[model samples]
Target chain A: MTDGILTPDQILSAAQDVLRRYGPAKATVVDVARALGVSHGSVYRHFPSKTALREAVTQRWLDQAHAELATVLASDAPAGVRLREWLGALFRSKRKRALDDPELFATYVSLVTESSQVVEGHVADLVGQIRQIVDAGLARGEFAAPDPAATARAVFDAAVRFHNPAHAAEWSRPGIEDDFTALCDLILLGLEVR
Target chain B: MTDGILTPDQILSAAQDVLRRYGPAKATVVDVARALGVSHGSVYRHFPSKTALREAVTQRWLDQAHAELATVLASDAPAGVRLREWLGALFRSKRKRALDDPELFATYVSLVTESSQVVEGHVADLVGQIRQIVDAGLARGEFAAPDPAATARAVFDAAVRFHNPAHAAEWSRPGIEDDFTALCDLILLGLEVR
Candidate 1:
């Protein structure tokens, strides 16, 4: 698209490319504008400030994964299967981002501290997905949870090593996958009807 | 304690004092000696190098906690109760160290990366303690674990947020204790023979 007709999507794509090149530190509204063949004002028009633009990039990256997870939830599989798949998908996606696109991955991770609301929303959304699966399990008499919300939170927190960015360094360890699987199995056990 | 004669414990105590005042980076044998009213050579006689001295200090800190945990394990309580108390102690000790002695905790955590063998041994030791509990539980037929070692690891990893230094910043968050107890309860459910 031409500079005059720059859409937010077009600008976001360009912003991603800029962030991928220079990371969040050196990359700025000016660079994003340069990448999109537009002035800084155009980028600012869509995102009021540099932090907003960076947050948008992070939000966009997270939304893609969210979309994929939404598909897993949309699947007609058993709640248990969906729950496992959902967590696996989250871990796999995060692992890939941390391993494959390290620059962009780091960009978003660094933003996580500054953009608390974004991070908070992302967590709440993911936990909500888990809650849905857990609530479904309880409703189907497939699981026994004294507190369904806490059950879901426990499951989410239980697998923290698999998804928490701080533990990303261990994600590549030889037995980390086995560790993830073991934790998942145990959580499933805890969630199943007792 | 004359200046000419000093025990390793005395040097270690002085080193701890020096570390508390100067942290690991600026702390040196000379500083430790000054604190102990002895020559730096006297300090070096007990510790060959700064790294060795720092490692010794960290080992001392961890050993004290290890001694406490050993007592918890020696208790005649049921394996389940022992397990709960054991994890609780680990969490509480780490939490207290991080909160009450921020400098020392930061020193240990920073040393963790460079001192992989130290960190690795610490983890192995802690995991072994958990494994002991799991083995006892299985021996009494009080817990159901297909793979006892993996069960112990899962339990440890499941509570990473409560104990991991990386999440130390969140240790002060309101309701974090409830979250810890909630996770422990879920894990206990997973462990008990069903």
Candidate 2:
């Protein structure tokens, strides 16, 4: 109903709630504007296009997950432990979203389906987190990867079974935790090779 | 068309053709039977249920891929080369399947989605193949993995992006080949740590 006063961040925040209520397919800019009590033109002024707004929401959702892992990455734990915890955190975070809020997770999955670039950016951010842990390990002489960034990528891809949305169904099966730990150990062993 | 003369193999061959022609969702046992000029009863006799028939077709499809890689695994080449070639073959095989026969591959993806057990068995077979290669490498003192089976699983999970149908869209992205090679090199380094 009003404009000029509501920040773009506030509109995105309101859009997320509208998105959750309406779901991705039905959610519209006017609905987001209505939720924010602002004119549709105001929402358009901030995002320029509905796609941009949805993408921003996607990025915001991803960044929330990224922020959780950032804490682990920034912690002073040993690099190896930090690496393990970093990956564990990512898996748990995704699983929580999937299990706790299935509808919202479905909405995000739709958003990701519509925009591969969002998933790519999310993955890039994850790899960057892993790289930090790896670089720390290499500096501490606890790991021997030739390229920290490449190793970060390999580690991320290797654990896709547990974290990748595609294989989410498999994550709930019995003994999956064991599989995760076993793979992590193998990677850690490979990382610790001196 | 005579029940006494028509072998199960012939029925399966016709089923493959019918599945390809109609796609999995519309394809039926009667269609398969009709294709072979036999009664649906004959098809039902070989496969007790439609699920069983679809599963058998899925297994048949997977076996084709397995048979190709089995040759690489069973070769007399060094284990390192064999492992690299084995992974390369798997990625290439999957890529070929995804690209060469999009319809059949889509049918296979749908089948796998319906039957997790089939996918589980396929993964087991692949992990078994990797285990054999790892065991051989360890025996020859070319690799140092403590658990060849677990290592094989790690390697399989790591290279999943290249092989998993869910990530088919990303496989065609520019620089994906480099990403594959980089990850493979990282896994190889981990395996070769002595």
TM-scores, one per candidate: 0.94, 0.93
How well is each residue in B52-145 modelled by candidate 2, as lDDT tens digits? 9889888888888667797898799888889889988988888888988888888888887788798778889888989999999899988888
Show the lowest summed lDDT stretch of 10 residues, model 1 chain B.
B1-10
Please name the candidate that would achieve the greatest DockQ relative to the true structure: 1
User: Top model by TM-score, which number?
Assistant: 1
Instruction: Classify candidate 1 by CAPRI docking class.
Output: medium
How well docked is model 1, in DockQ terms? Answer: 0.79
The ten-residue window of minimal lDDT in model 2 chain A covers A185-194
- The sequence of per-residue lDDT tens digits that candidate 2 reaches over residues A82-149 is 98898898889888888888888888888987887887787787888788888888988889887777
Over B3-112, each residue of candidate 1 has an lDDT whose tens digit, in order, gives 55678777777777888789777888888888877777777888899889888887887887566699898887878899889988988888888999888888778766
Model 1's interface RMSD: 0.7
